[model samples]
Target: MRQTLSNPPSGKKTIKQRFLKLLPCCRSDSTSPIIQNSVDDDFELSTVCYRPEGLDKLMQVTKFDKRELQILYRSFKSECPSGAVDEETFKLIYSQFFPQGDSSNYAHFLFEAFDKQKNGAVSFDDFVTSLSIILRGSVTDRLSWAFNLYDLNKDGCITKEEMTSIIKSIYDMMGTYTYPCIRDDAPKEHVESFFQKMDMNKDGVVTMEEFLASCQKDENIMQSMHLFENIL
Candidate 1:
């Protein structure tokens, strides 16, 4: 996986495209309201095999056996009181982990990924599976997730406009404390550098293949992707 950054072999599917195929199959519509003030009761009730089929599938994807899954679900339900966590709630909760409570951009992208159904909220199932990937998935899995985060339009590619927008949002999330007090032109410069290395064919757009290739070869990028690991 650490060869030169280049187009994947023809006929070999990009990880991002393959991941997109799996996304539809993985989504769940579990809208059961969170049992507030009943964590113990919820644990007891869960022992009876509620949503056995769904739980089975979740375990299959997450590799978290019954006990671990139950523990995570209990924790998730405790935080998401309404059975689902809305973006605002997620942002607020996620921000608390940051030194300045300024994780808005990262949290926004993470919430978007976890909200698999694009329904403006994250269900318990959604929370568990996505967290599993972030916590334990392989590098390829993490890269696919990163690509999904940057491909804001869901069009299977990243455009210059999207890169600029995302970078701007990240800077905005940093508030006034963003170091170096970078110039106004910094975002464009960053976007240009990204395209220079990642666009491959200079088509003014970056396909998932290119993004994966570039990131895979860059040790710093790979390391940075796991920056939140300790906090998590």
Candidate 2:
């Protein structure tokens, strides 16, 4: 049976309700009914089609045309029954692909990048914008997005601890694949190597400048930018 957007799973809260729940923590006057109305306004705004100028800009920026964008939006909304996907839902959806290990941390980082609003939930606009960049944006755009994810503290720098944690999450997600199992320290070694190569200032922290300069110079980084695009 085909499910329309109107027919979300029974007993589950609607996406609007979920957004309301998210609003309280984000605002100073969360208890006010006016705040609830503001949330309602924002939710309505997010679901609207892009204006003609905006659509034209999107076509210019991304590979998706109008028809393609419509199709993708439908699929994205259907998968997310609530009309928006929170981090936990995003993590669960991604973890299924790995089938061997915990991908919670990687999904966490990926979701952070996707939540362009930084409001703890991904709107349709957020999903499309981030996806377009990952699939077809320029090298500089992709690298900048990645650095944002690695900069967990949002302090404009990537720390060794943050890099190690993300790398460890990725390795954990990889699990024991093939005949030769990966050692526990493999992620640590990988982090060390990455920092050794990219940390140009020897300050133990990588600024965005260093990340971009190093990534732009690396043949491997340039080659690997589109690796995930094929899967999409």
Candidate 3:
């Protein structure tokens, strides 16, 4: 049976539930107390009401409407009472959704992707902007973001080493959940396959142009994109 976010099996919070905990509008009240109290005491949810400014500007740039933005802001404030999330806290929250695996490396990369300013923190705006792209942006936009995630150095191109690292991190994050039990050399093999199609110029690295063209032209990849729509 397809599990619903509101009723995760075994009372363990699914990735979707952990994700929803960062967006109040869709959150359920049945969250496990163990999970609810997992946040550090120093960063506990505060009773203070935080009103995020620049709703007009955010709406213009992202896909969220005014009401949705407000709801997101509330959720952000609840999790990050200080209006920003540091990398450590971000990793903690992300790790919760993948207890069966070591999500630290993956979380590190994801945190860097969301930390647009490279300021060592993710503000409410930064959070929503990326969330908007992942959950609602156009295919090109989403692909661009995914490319950025893989481009660890922010060097505008993804090398085999970079892709390998990302694939390995993903494997580590999926742990035993990966069907058929991925082989030890799975990450290397995965990178080789990606490079075969993505590095169209035989340049040993995939540029943004190449990545976009390759993915956009692939019917299977386009269809698979929908599987991640609920990941926010």
Best by TM-score: 3
Question: Weakest 10 consecutive residues, lDDT, candidate 3?
Answer: 1-10
Residue 199 lDDT (model 2): 89
Q: Residue 37: error of model 3 in Å?
A: 29
Model 2, position 155: C-alpha lDDT score = 97
The whole-model lDDT of each prediction reads 0.65, 0.66, 0.74
User: 51-110 in candidate 1: lDDT tens per residue?
Assistant: 779888888888566666665665555566577989998787666444342568767876
Q: What is the Cα-based TM-score of model 2?
A: 0.71
lDDT for 208 in candidate 2 is: 92
Off by over 4 Å in 1: 1-49, 95-106, 224-232
TM-scores, one per candidate: 0.70, 0.71, 0.80
Tens-digit lDDT track of model 3 for 80-118: 888899999989988878787888998899899999999
lDDT agreement of model 2 with the native: 0.66
Give the Cα error of residue 21 in candidate 1, in Å.
32
Q: What local lDDT score does residue 162 receive in model 3, on the 0 to 100 scale? A: 95
